[model samples]
Target: MNNEEYVFAPDDFVLAGNDHDAFIDDTYFKQSYWKDMLSRFTKNKGAVVGLFVIFLIILMAIIGPGLNEYTYDFQTISHQNLAPRIELLEPLGIFDGSETMSTSTGMVEINKYVSEDGSLTGLEDTYYWFGTDVLGRDIFTRTWEGTRISLYIALVAVAVDMLFGMSYGLISGYFGGRVDMVMQRISEIINGIPTLVMVTLLIIVMKPGLGTITLALAIRGWIGMSRIARAQVLKLKEQEFILATKTLGAKDFFIIFKEILPNIFGQLIIMSMFSVPNAIFTEAFLAFVGLGVPQPLASLGSLISDAFKSFTTHPYMIIFPVIVLALIMLSFNLLADGMRDAFDPKMKEM
Candidate 1:
């Protein structure tokens, strides 16, 4: 057939749509940057679960210590070493306030609420949900209080990292040349020292308490944040918008805080989130090693440390605190991973 005749009919000719309607119609709703980020975040089931768990833990930390009639420091020698017993679950024979004492005749389960005469002990009405430690202090109260302390330590670390670290990095990166070199060298020197050694030294020099722990964490924790901020600033300072701001004679401080900060804020937030678990774990470790907050005031690490002494005999003592601490670390890590993917969708795994 002739070429002209083949295209002659109107029905034979079709318009090139190129899926333009699909592109233009845009069935999805328009969302702001933050909304989009949050949408992405919520889509991650692991992250969502982690967030919920963390929120629950935080709430528990706030109120768990207050749930029982007994205060964290309340001590009763008679109630010492009592196993966990929930009044509601007592019939299930689980957490029934019984301790398996190793007698000459082998393991003997003794119901602490009852005496050898099968009569109800006067203290039968009293319950220790998480049981009592050697000192008879309620474990439930101490656990929550310890969690509260861990959260406080994490908050302090994040604050120091954001304020001092971010500021230091911004200045050093923005100034460049001799300023960057000197600042980086100083950071390197600080970073070179092992964190454990420094914290231990600080604990030795100062009273071992929240203040000393916070100070120890702040000393080198901020260095990592500074390095990250410096890298981001170095990459962004020469960008066209930044150069335009510089051309407008914007002050250094204004440009650094007002201009640069907003752009890298997401990354910084993700970094801060990651830093939380690290801070918490570090504080726990310090407490475990006996350098944490002094007795009476407990941290998770300290609780674990105390519980470890009788772990073989009373394993329940160590279980509760360890579970809480592990959950916190895992939850924070999962949340941070979600935030990272949300902020930078390009980082999402295939």
Candidate 2:
């Protein structure tokens, strides 16, 4: 063996026995599209953070009011224009309400006021956390109430839009030619009118309530979604699966809903995410203009509307509401962006 000599090829070299298959991990064989998407979504820090924040917001909307003693509309001039009492340094027992805060020259202290029974009464000097509004309604409670209202409008509006839009687009795109043309032309007519203008007119007729805002937005909101769905259907309808489904005598409804709908679902999801924020903003605007949910019922917009009048005297009035609204919109946007990237195979390639 020691005397054996190895020959070397001049032009090329070939390696002998190497087994590479043993190194592959179990994960290589245990992945799926959804898992891939979820993996990618988790990797996006902004999207994940935004989504967590959104969840927190929803939880806040659900449980926040119950945790607090104050009702959103329960007015008590005793607490009006009170600054928030968060006591950020209170946790370690620093500024906790156990000790009286210094009622210095410029600061306000809890006051005593007469009750409706014509008797003098004193209020509990509790934390106002988010302070009080002009009418002395708890701003924190009202903000949550407004969140509930705005969320209601947004979800209902988006649902209406999705339902109507998906059906309209499926029918129109599945059956092209005259039917498509007629449907598209009709949509164009509806789209020609400014959505806000139409909604404004409708609000005038309906006189501003949850139903009115939902109806007004739904009346026109479906058009945009329908157009998006229609375009996607047109593209996918010409694909091989659709062609095979048509050849197999699948009913038109079956072809459209079953064969075509699932493939384009990702887009619908992303679009819906976007629509939620838009609907929330729209409702807030309407409320700001005095066309939102009626009086006594609070919405974020209505809160802002009320805040504007006391801007100089009470800047905190606007600050809290604006922060809540901005957070909601930003969260939705970031979540949608992440969802789009996660769900799109093309994005995965990039």
Query: Candidate 2: which stretches are off by over 4 Å?
Result: 1-30, 87-124, 345-350
Kindly give the number of clashing pairs for every candidate: 0, 1
Looking at model 1, the pairs that clash are: none
Question: lDDT per model, in order?
Answer: 0.89, 0.80
Q: Choose the strongest candidate by TM-score.
A: 1
RMSD of each: 5.1, 7.3
Task: Give the Cα-based TM-score of candidate 2 against the true structure.
Answer: 0.82
TM-score of each: 0.89, 0.82
lDDT (10s digit) by residue, model 2, range 248-275: 9999899888989999888887878878
Whole-model alpha-carbon lDDT for candidate 2? 0.80
The CA lDDT at 113 in model 1 is 76
For model 1, what is the error of residue 164's alpha carbon versus the real structure, in angstroms, after optimal superposition?
A: 1.2
